[model samples]
Target: MEFFNNHTKLFITAFLLFAGLTLLVCIIPALNNQSNNAPLPMAVPLSDMAIKGKGVFIANGCVGCHTQQVRNVDMDKVWGERPSIAADYADIHRTDFWRNTATLMGTERTGPDLTSIGTRQPSKEWQLPHLFNPRILIKESIMPAYPWMFEIKDKAQPGDVVVNIPEEYLGGRKGKVIAKAEALELLAYLQSLKQTKLPSASPQPAFLYGKVGEESDAKPGATKELNGGMLYTNNCQSCHQQNGEGLKGAFPPLKGSKVVTAEDPELLVNIIMNGYTGREKEGYPAMPPIGTNNRLKAEEISAIMNHERTSWGNSAKKVTVDEVKKLMEKVKVKAK
Candidate 1:
């Protein structure tokens, strides 16, 4: 009867019981499950720089806008090759004793899902400028810029990474914009977000609710119709405006480019296949090798080229898939 009146003893007894239950029911099973769950064979561990970059990613609140997971739905297919699995994130360890942000599988995608951004947009040239000021890449981008990640210098010192900023975005500051270590680290983390491939024996879950009987039966090398305008919007519209007027002192204009309107489409095709560097001497950043990186099919390349040729007041001869396919083969051979 006296024990029942002791409030301190009662509280201590309740706390001990709760802790025991937690250890037995929650923590113990979690530890066991974690040990059993191994990373996928294809999963690459984060490099030291990438780990630091992951800290930067979390600090910048990138998870608020972007998502790391790709759901098992038809609409999510564009974000990754396959649906995400537990093994994909099994290797992620805790940040620290106080913080348990191990799984950065963010919800509510305010921006595009980053499950396979490394494979989709691997170009550092594109990624750097995008981080500096998304408006430089995407005019209508609502995402805020992180200028603190870079510095402006009158002259780049040795081993300095000089990022090309638009003349207008320089805020009247004179000098080259150089990427700070934080920016490079952030880029490293972003570039490491590739999805792990599943083994042949264990297939991945298919995207649900996709259109029935939409699968194609075309031969592997056969020509197929591709959407040029849509491809342009996806790939090129960021650098070149929809109106074909590129940013002055940054991206070159294609509206009246001699390369675009030339009778000999060979040079144009070569530039598309293997990126152009001559424009870098003109203060514009060197173009990324989109055709190679994207592994665009002949029909897709032809569509993009033809779209650039005929639109925006430029009337040029339409390129064929055969021409591009043969040229691409020659380009690959020449590279060797």
Candidate 2:
């Protein structure tokens, strides 16, 4: 007993020493700014909305359900661009280095990863309506209403107020109010969800090439001459016009547009085959996947696009039926 009591102090001293050493190993460099010189690579700055939405995202605990990082194999199969990298979070500055550590790193994801939500769903109006009430858009969603973050304003007043009343209440019923800034911020964060370098591959058809464009770049042949002016008058002139000056802001002006006149003819071919719609900058009322007459073959789409490209001082190479067929296959594969 006497010996055991005597060694208690030694035992305590040894334990304390070990703990102190562990603490030093963890804390010493952090306290002394040892790795502070290793700066993160710069990324594009977030919009004001995105910055605000990030705060809302943190506040509402969306991370409890959704994840940001995606695995490489899953991303490849989904064709979801690159996998999550720590560098992707370089722009996400946080005040407390400790509390915000995961924000700067990553967290465990439970729901479908949000790594590409921005590009997947880019319409601001869609996002706004979706946030006001998720069930309105996604009938099966389990998310709670963020009504507190929105305003209730009357449409009758026609003021500068943004409201969050249910769409049903728009018929002159007194509306509830919410904060526009908060909604805008939440959208900003959602819009920041895209994480890819090439959301859309260049508009080349794949069959013209031996394989998919991503797999190989084998170019296709020149298009065959067809009755382009008659085709335009009968089909395209209604929307695209005889001169190819489409409805400004509604349909794109094909005369000198980048997609039509690029050095690569694939750009024009892909659009005709797939049809597209994005931001105003991207073009609107995207050409229908099927032609206006609905039976225009791959050769027809190619000839028309090629003729348009050359007719308006476009100076780009022409598209061909084989290229159109190739891209059609690629788009179909991607759609799958």
Candidate 3:
């Protein structure tokens, strides 16, 4: 009894010291950082709706099934970017709070990485439909429908169809209508998943870089190098079509176009490398800038430029590696 009573104060002091240490080491910093270091996405703000949706996301433990970070090895192999950093999370913040915790660093990868999910898929209409019911869009989706997060509504606007809500949903207490605000906020978060680069019109290889360094020129007429055809098929065909007669106004017609078969191939090479818009002299649909597909090699652009000029009735001169080199230099200067 004498020993116990004497040590009681020491034991209490020790316990208090340990608890204080833990609070300072882990709890205090987390609380401080969470209030000050959360992310604020460049695209949109965390409005009341988005905040509510974020609560829903957390309440459902979406992070347990999905991940938001991309490691260096995965980025290099899959998308060619580096891993996540603290700077990337500097967006979410408030005057008094933030959400800067190290989240989604878990063992599960049940769903795809959503770090760049918004940019990966940017269709608001598509996101809404998918959220309404996953099975409708993806037959194999294992995700449960977040019907409770949705509020079914009537046709408030013209052509706005009234979507169905599950009967047991919390939001559908009296079969409440779809809350458009919540849907938009959730979409704002999802639309931010674009992590990959855009598709190129004609991605070229390494050998196409310079003035044919001894390895240039075909082996005695090897059928005009059928290399670039595959690139064209993959990237260009969607708008240009297999026959190259692009959609009337949406995409310019490549066949029989003056720009395609012109005598000087530098213009075409520049168009491919730097991208072209405005009407061609022949008056066709304007092309978009090469914003998405910037990965095409200079040589591939040259080859495809040469191929198009020759194949489509126009006897334009072939665009050589020398020409591509020159034009690429010029484009780089202009880009600067």
On TM-score, the candidate that comes out on top is 1
Displacement of the residue 274 alpha carbon in candidate 3, Å: 12
RMSD to true structure for each model, in Å: 4.9, 13.0, 11.1
Give the poorly placed runs of model 3, Cα more than 4 Å off. 1-11, 27-45, 75-80, 91-107, 149-181, 192-336
Which window of 10 residues has the lowest lDDT sum in candidate 2?
202-211
Relative to the true structure, how large is the alpha-carbon lDDT of every model? Answer: 0.85, 0.58, 0.56
TM-score each candidate. Answer: 0.76, 0.49, 0.46
Tens-place lDDT per residue, model 1, 1-336, is 777799999889999999999999999999898888899988999999989999999999999999999899888876877889888899999999999988889987988889888877665777888999998888888898999999999999999988877788988999989999999998999899998888889876898988775437667766567889998887778887788998776688999999988887877777777777887788776776677655567888899999999999999999898888888888877767
6-115 per-residue lDDT for model 3 (tens digits): 78877987899999999999999968876775442333444665566555566568778877766655222222133555435545453335655334444577866667
How would the candidate models be sorted by TM-score, starting from the highest?
A: 1, 2, 3
lDDT of 2 by residue, 1-336 (tens): 665677887798789999998789867865455344322333456777677788788788888777776555432223134555544554556645565623522365444466766754554544565566665444456767675666665443444434323546344546544457777788778877766342254232122112234423434654346666666554455455566776444455778878778776665555554556654465354354434113467766776777777886778777667877787677657646
Q: Give the range of the ten consecutive residues with the poorest summed lDDT in model 1.
A: 213-222
Q: Count the backbone clashes (under 3 Å) in each candidate.
A: 0, 17, 26
